[model samples]
Each structure stands twice: as structure tokens, then as C-alpha cells.
Target chain A: MTVLDIPSGIPAHVDTPAPGDPRLARLSLNQRTTANWDLREAVEGAVAAGLPAIGLWREPVAEVGVDVARRIVDDAGLRVSSLCRGGFFTASDRAERTRAHEDNLRALDEAAGLGTKALVLVPGGLPAGDKDLAGARARAAEAIAALVPAAVVRGVTLGIEPMNPIYAADRGVISTLAQALDIAEQFAPHEVGVVVDTFHLWWEPGVYAQIARAGERIVSYQVCDWITPLPADSLLARGMMGDGHVDFPAFTRAVAAAGYTGDVEVEIFHADVWAAPGDQVIATMARRYVELVQPHL
Target chain B: MTVLDIPSGIPAHVDTPAPGDPRLARLSLNQRTTANWDLREAVEGAVAAGLPAIGLWREPVAEVGVDVARRIVDDAGLRVSSLCRGGFFTASDRAERTRAHEDNLRALDEAAGLGTKALVLVPGGLPAGDKDLAGARARAAEAIAALVPAAVVRGVTLGIEPMNPIYAADRGVISTLAQALDIAEQFAPHEVGVVVDTFHLWWEPGVYAQIARAGERIVSYQVCDWITPLPADSLLARGMMGDGHVDFPAFTRAVAAAGYTGDVEVEIFHADVWAAPGDQVIATMARRYVELVQPHL
Candidate 1:
């Protein structure tokens, strides 16, 4: 009678995979989940909570100065799964794109400085004042090409995060995980791939196939929930786990089944969730992750 | 500099194709774009604006009566691309689902009666109090199975409209065109397919490929722009063409290239756009269609 045990064989369950394999414990937390905090505080908080790894953000690193970012991370014995992001390559002019690439170069430096494994990339949104999707994508590609060598030299894999099309106008132009994979496939496997964030891709149908395609290129897996009445801004309003409709367990299984051997990171975008006491949010996250996401494993 | 020119290897514009070539003109506008009218008024407005087809909402039809809805469409030389909608199958009990099926049966009858080529199905959002996406989807698929046969008997195609994930809790469980197609493909081609509404799907990364795969099965293509700072309620604030971020012309071309020769209709979901004078809205629509989408032709 349980929802997961439908007798009809329709496969509606989110919790189909049996967990308890040691891999289940490898889940990490993307530090941006607490983007409001300073780098060292995030590291200390995450370490206190026993999260295995942390995805670091760039701004805070810069705010505290890169040297401090590196020291605090090292001092805490924390692992940097990825540097927050780089690559807002789509722009109306060449100079802007070049600037984006330059910024990415520094981001790569930051990632390398912090010993991050990958530099997450969001290939800018629809170019400002431009209506050409294809052209903007080309610009983004060129920018990435410019940044790839630095990334390679730094030993930081590029994690391309294709935002949902809702952001096609002002955010990253790479709008689907599949599109990221397509671009990544053209490069060396370790050179580029994707960071699949459930919040951005929960609405996509080809998600399963894309994740499978990403395989080794699947550098990061993130979790967040989609809430209704998108805030006027559309940047915030992310629901917590079990609050929205993503079939997380099913998604987790699909990711795991596709040979992903990385950490599972919960990265929420809700302002309210952020405003709550950090300790409370972290505790809730751990509980919900286990209660809802764990069953799938 | 044009976004449309991205990866220019593919055709930059949509092909209008020959009349009767269902592949070229696949989109159908929901007269709600002219928010101030009944079915008769919408049909007349659509024709005067030079659009070939429309999706008729039930409110308008009820106000004018089916015969009138049928007559206005016929007199104005507009194709009834689809009925406003039918579905919301997820329920707290069997009786609720039965009621939903009955309602869909009525919608199918109206679609047939109105001479529309298809019935647009907006599967109900989360059952009044459930967070189970898989369950709601299963219920919807089951409802479709029950209703598709009747739709076929009436020579009407069923177009499942996958709303954006924002509506998963209140408006629809089928939240992506690809998921709809998967369910649609499971049934006879003549009975089930999908409606690709840009307002709902523009955010999806798989929109392009799904439309291509849809080919003749793409029963409807509606358009509306996503206005950021989404309204407090999900239903209102959809932008009119040329006002928001959807790459309308490109989408039109992609659907056309895939071999859909249906009518190209604009479906806007904006309160402001809807609140404006009907004539002014139509003029803007006509202008946008000509400047943006029609150019591809």
C-alpha cells in the first residue's frame, strides 16, 4: 500500500535503490547553500556538521582575500569539491566576453589556490540586447575555449552548469544539462563536463539520459526544490527537500546508476532558508536528506 | 550579435512550409492573449490579426455557447487548434479522479464539437494536498488512457501541456513537454501527443529536441514570455510576445523544421497584457509575430 510499492509496476517510486553501500555516506554540501556566510565560517560550520566536502564560492574568498581562503580551508582540513563558478561568456560585445574570460582566469586561480577540484562554469545568459541564442552560445564557447588552458594548467576540471531557460535572458546561456554534456563531449573528458543541479533541471525530460551521458563528466550533483509562484525575481524562492515536486530519490538513483562516484551536495536557493539559524538549517538539511533522499539509496 | 544565429550550422529561421504541411506552422495561440473577450471575439481577433489558429478557453465557450464557439471560428476562418484544457487527474480518492475523467470527456466532446483539431490537457497540479509527483503523474497517465480513446473517436488529438515546475504543486503534475510526449507516445499516435506552450516550456532545456521528436505529434504550440518577479500567483503576469525572453521565432522555426505544419498561435499568460485593450493586444501580437516569428518563414 505504500506509494513506493505500487503493484502496477508503473515505477513511480523515488526510493528504488537500496543504500547502505559506503558510497551513501559520501554526500557533501555546496557552501553556497550558506552563501550568506564568510568562507572560513562555512568551512568551520560544515566541518562541525561532519559534511565530507564543501563546494566553495568565489566572492567570499575574494572578500576575505584569496590567501585567507586558502589558509582557512587548509586549517579546517576541508575538501573543496568545486569553486563556486566562472564563465558568464555571453555578452553583446567582444570586450565584455573577453572580460568574462579574464574573470574566469582569476576564478581558476582562486580554485587552484583553494585546492578545489573543479571550476563550476555558467556560460552566461542570452546576450544583453541580443535575440540570437545560437550566436550567444558561440560567444560562450569561445570564452570557454580561452579559459580551458588555464583550467587545465591549474588541474581544475571545468564544471559547466546549464541553468534552466528561465534564466536564458540574464543568467547562463547553457540552459540544459544535456547541452552542457554536448559541449563537454567535444573536449577532453577531464577538461570539461557538468554540474547537475536538480533545482535547475527538475523540469527537463531528458535529464536521465543527459546524466547518463555526463557519466565521467558528471563533476557535481546538487539538490534543491522548485517552489511555485516564482518570486518576481525568479532568482530566489527555492523550496527545501520534500517541500516541492522533484523525485529526488529517483533522480539520485539515476545519477548513481550512471557511474557517478562523487559527493552529493545539497545547494538550496531560498532566502528564508538562508535567514534561518544556520545550525537549524544544517540540521534540517541533514535530517531531510536522510529521510527523503536516503530512502532512494 | 543575434541570439538566433547561434551554432549557425542549423537553419537560422523557421520554415513556413506549404499550407497543409502540419510541420511548418505548429503553434496555436490561446485567445487569452486578447484577455478581454469570449470565444467568438477571440476567433475574430485572431483572424483579423492574421493568425491561423487558437486554443479556446472554456470560460469563453461557456459564455457564448458551443454552437457560437463553433460558428465564430468557422466564420472568421480560424482553426480551433485545441480546447483550453482538460485534466487535474491526481486526487485524494477514486471519486475525484472519476469526476476529472468525466470533465475531460466533456472537454473532448467540446473539442470535437468546436471543430478544434486537438484538446489541450493541463494535467491537474498536485492533488489538493499531496507532494507526490510520481503519483500525480501516474494518475494523469491513467486518466489519459481512459480519455484518449474518446478523443480519438471524435477525431481530435489530445495535446498534453506540460506546465513549468512552478505549477507542480498547484496546477500540473506533467511539468515538461518530454514527459508528456513519453506518455503520449505510449498511446496510439492519433490519440495522444502534446502541446508545446513556450510560456510553460521556454525554461526547459529539452524543448528543442522534444519539438523535433514531436514532429506531427506536436498538437499545439502556445507562446507567452516569462516576466521576472513572477506574480504572487503563478497564473498571471505572463508577457506578450516581444516583451519577455522566449526566443519565439527560433522556437517557431524549430517546431516547423521538425515537420509540424499546424497553425502558429500566441498564448500569453500576462495580467498586464491581458488587461490591455483587446485590439491593442492583437496589434502588438500581429506586429511581434511578423517581426520575430514570421521573419523565419
Candidate 2:
């Protein structure tokens, strides 16, 4: 209803800007946001809503059978912008790491089959029973190096998502976009660039400069508003746009200006949001993303 | 107890360096880590544990006269290393910011009265309904500048505690140690440095290098461990010493090598740890800090 305030550099998409349904405008769904959401329902909803991209996870794809997931995605005319994740590469044992590399190869195969742009990665957290973060990072780099050739053959760039430090213990040790990008460049220039997710990165001291530096290499960007005083074991409690104090409008605007024309996907992980009807949650996010987030284009 | 293969380079303090009770180390109790462990009980526990310092909060002091709190700390020979917090400096309105400046002065008086070395700061999250993080940080700096002289007069450095990104929305905007030190240098080097808590900053990308860079400017140091997929709200779920995967030995070594000789306080916030008796919690922490943390010293 209000004039769309999409940031300066983005296209109006005026021809289909609102299309009377915000769902039609943004079609990507981040699988991890609401951990409890059913994978099948997610796919059906994306199809029903005319979303163009549906991010897939290796576990879900494997569980659902790649063919079935591939059929669903292809039939829905959805582009798999990214796979849920690959790369908990740090391991104390060589056998586990080799197994991981083989598993990653399988993941690459799955991604090629699904036709996603990049395998979104959360390079492993601190190694089990060990406390060498720098060493864990080195192990992650070595794992990435081991997998790069397979990824190249698969024709995909590995998107390294730098998670927030709150997860530095067990989630992913790569905790900054700059750190991720630096490591990414060391391996291969076009092969990697950091995946800038607002939830993981909004608080990063030099987030803006990193985004500007990312430029075309960014390729994939994710959005989730940050909420504070998070419940211990913070599996949920993410705020919807405009609710939390995150500067989403400026956040999206910066990267978009940096030339990432991909979808500004909405990713939420609030327990409240997950418990609600999926459609209702998506509807709310779609509306807000268009209203507040779209304003920054 | 059998000697676990302790990482080398750390000194041995595990032989009960103090006396009969191994339960008298953790130099202070962080109020935020324990709910309902009020100012009086906290100080009493500190005195019993032979703790030299305490991290106090404003609310408890307000409820029970500041004069009373001040006397208890001094009488017990306990130092108020740093006031719990002050610096929700992010505000959309100028009036609110000006009021924050006024509150900061009052905090300065409180710090002076308690003879605290520093006033811990949790710089405000984003401006209300605004999306400019840089701007919010600028406002925080301005507020610090306005309040620095008052802090200087009292010989209290506004100890900036760079909280984790999980707190970027509601609690603090200062998300990294390097940025905080930069802000300290810019505004008033002598008036500010930082309160380095491994809990909040361990995952910082360039932390090791920054610790060395921070040099003698680190006014305080704290520790707690992070668990992954951090609690939906991470206010709780902090791991105790030797509990979580934090490389505490390496962390303290970095700080100590950086020329810091301050106390290595264990600041935990797990529900499991706090549910037990306060005395019991302090005893375990003190014992563990000696066995585990002191080695890294």
C-alpha cells in the first residue's frame, strides 16, 4: 500500500513488485530458521506460494531421497540457492575427516543433482575434546582444500557462512565474514566468498566493510533479525523484521549496493514462530520482508 | 586425582596454593551469571571465598542503599573491580541519550564511592526503530566522551565489555574487543580500556592478536564457556571451568603473555550451577579455577 522504499541500486521489479502476494516476490525458505518445520510442508508451501528458491539441507535431502527432493524442486520451478550445509571439517581423527570428505563428495553430488548454486557451509566448531580454535580453523581449511576439486567438478562454489561466536564452541569456528573470506580467497578466488547472514553477522565490528569487499563474490545473502537476552541453549527466539533492534534496512541495502542481486531470503528461528502455522509464519515474514526489508532493497 | 595431560607452558597452582580449603579462589561473582544472588549475599560469599574483587550491578545497589553496599565491600576487604554495567547508550531520541549521560555521572559517583577501578559498559543495541549500527556506536562513543571526565575524576575507567553478537540487539552493541579498544583510544585512552571476558570475546576472530594489541590497557578479565546452538536465549547455559570446550589455558596464556597479570575470574551462568547452594557454587569454581585455570597462568 505504501510506496515501496527499495534501496537505490535495486530494480523496482515494478512489473511484478507486489503481485498482490508478497510470497510471489520472495520465494526462498531457509530450512534451519524454524528447526521444527516439516521439510515436505516447506517444499509444498514454497510451491504453493510461487517462491523461486528453496534452500535444502543434506540431512533432509538424504532423508527425503534426492530424486524426490529434486523432482519437487524442479517441478516447482524453484532454484536451490544453496544446500543447508556442509563442512564441519575439523576433526581430531584422520578417518573421520576422510569420511567427512567422502560425505562432502556425496553432498556435492546431491547439490549438482538439485542444482543449487553453492553448498552453504558451517566449517566445524572447536574439535571434539580439544581447544585449538586456530588449529580447528586450519583443519577446516585443509578439509576445504581436500574438497575443492570435487566441488569444482560438481561446478559449485562453497559458500562459507560465518556463524556468530555464540556457536564458536560447537557449531562453526569460522565466526566472521572477513575471516571466512580470507580463508576462502586462499583456496580459490571464484570458488568461495563468505555467505553474509544478518543473524550471524549483524554484531560483527567490521560487517559493513566486509560486505562492501565481498561484492560479486557474495552470491548468497541471508536475513534473520537478532533478538536479545536469548534463552539458554538458544535454538530459537529469533525476532521477525522490525521487531528486533537489527538494522535490516541498512543491512540489506549495503550488500545490494555491493551488487548482490539475489533474493533477500527471510530466515527466522523463534520457537514462537515455528509453533505457529507455517503459512502464517511465512505470511508474516513475507509481509515484513517486503515492507521493512524491501525498503532497503 | 590423576594428572590429566595438561597442556604445557602453564604454571602449576593446583597444589592448593592457599590453605586448608581448596574452595577459595574465584576472585569475584558476576551478578548476571546468577539470578537472585543479590548484592549482600554476593559480597558475603566473596568475603568467605577470600575473593579480592566483585562485579556489582546497579539495580541491587538501588534497592539496598549504595552506601550500605559500598561499606560491605570495603569492610570485607573486597575490591569492586568493576560496576556491573551502564551504557545502553543506543537511543533514537537526543533526550534519551542526554539522560543516559546523566545516569552515567551517577554511575561514576557510585563507582567512586565503591572505589571500583572501572564501570562495565554494555553499549546500547541499535537505535530504536533505526537501522544504523555505525551510528549507534557513534552515539555510544559520544556518550562515553561526555561521561569520561567524570570517570577520570573518580579514577574509574569506563570498562567496555565487548559482549557476544547474541547480545547485539538488546544488551550491547560493542561486539568485539578490537572495536572497543579503538573506541577507548579515540575517546579517552587513559579514561577507558576494556573488560576482557573470555565468555564474550573468545570467539572474536583476531582475539589473540588483539589481546597483544590491547597490552596493558585491559582493565579486567573474565571467563565462562559457550555451548553451541547456544540457548535460544543465551543468558543462561554458561559452562564452568573444565566443563565446556573453551581453550581456557590458551586464552589466559594469551592475556598473560600480553602483559596482563590480573585475576582470572570464573563467571559462569548455568542453571545447573546456580541451582545449588551459592557457597557450593563458589567452592567448586574456586577449586576448579585453581586446578584448571591457574595452570594457564
- Candidate 2 wrongly placed segments (more than 4 Å): A1-26, A31-43, A228-233, B1-26, B29-41, B60-70, B228-233
Name the lDDT of candidate 1: 0.73
- The model with the greatest DockQ is 2
lDDT by candidate, in order shown: 0.73, 0.73
The residue ranges of model 1 lying beyond 4 angstroms of the native Cα positions read: A1-29, A259-261, A294-297, B1-29, B36-54, B71-79, B90-94, B126-142, B165-190, B201-213, B227-232, B255-262, B295-297
Q: Could you give the CAPRI-style class of model 2? A: medium
**DockQ of candidate 2 relative to the true structure:** 0.60
The native-contact fraction of candidate 2 is 0.94
